[model samples]
Target: MEDDGRGFSFTVGSSELVDVGRDSGVWDVFVQAEENAPLARIGRLLDDVADRKEIFVYPSITLGATDVRPYYTVDNDLSLEVARQN
Candidate 1:
């Protein structure tokens, strides 16, 4: 899981469903999110490098745990379905 600078489990986007965090190099992306920014800082410090990809818009976030849900909404509506366990 990626931290949104506050050490909280940061989700890259608005999709609520939990995504498999296998060795897909995703963590690398998060760690190197902004190469131009310092590796450590307060309030969403980000440094951009030539190869860094812009992901999160905000930097600082309240430190918290992200409780995994059993399901996610299929659409912007209230409809829901159970998430399959690995």
Candidate 2:
């Protein structure tokens, strides 16, 4: 997350959702996974991205738990935009 005291910004890479506000300069990025995806897989993905870039990663959460079933979701969203050549 990047901020200028008065506003906030988010940057994201491929395979994520980037949301840009028209009036506000704020942006948000997020990736949602269905219940079928495993929690370990999501952690690996976050680890892989962090290894490639200098970024902050929030923890993952388990939505529900049971003896035979479990669920999880990403708590933080990232924001990104394409770079323009000069």
Q: After best superposition, candidate 1 residue 52: deviation in angstroms? A: 32
lDDT of 1 by residue, 1-86 (tens): 77567554444452333344431111112233466965532122245432222332223222122223221122211112223343
Candidate 2: segments with Cα more than 4 A from true spot? 1-21, 35-77, 81-86
lDDT of 2 by residue, 41-66 (tens): 22224454534223553343222220
Lowest-lDDT window of 10 residues in candidate 1? 71-80
Error of 1 at 83 (Å): 12
TM-score of 1: 0.16
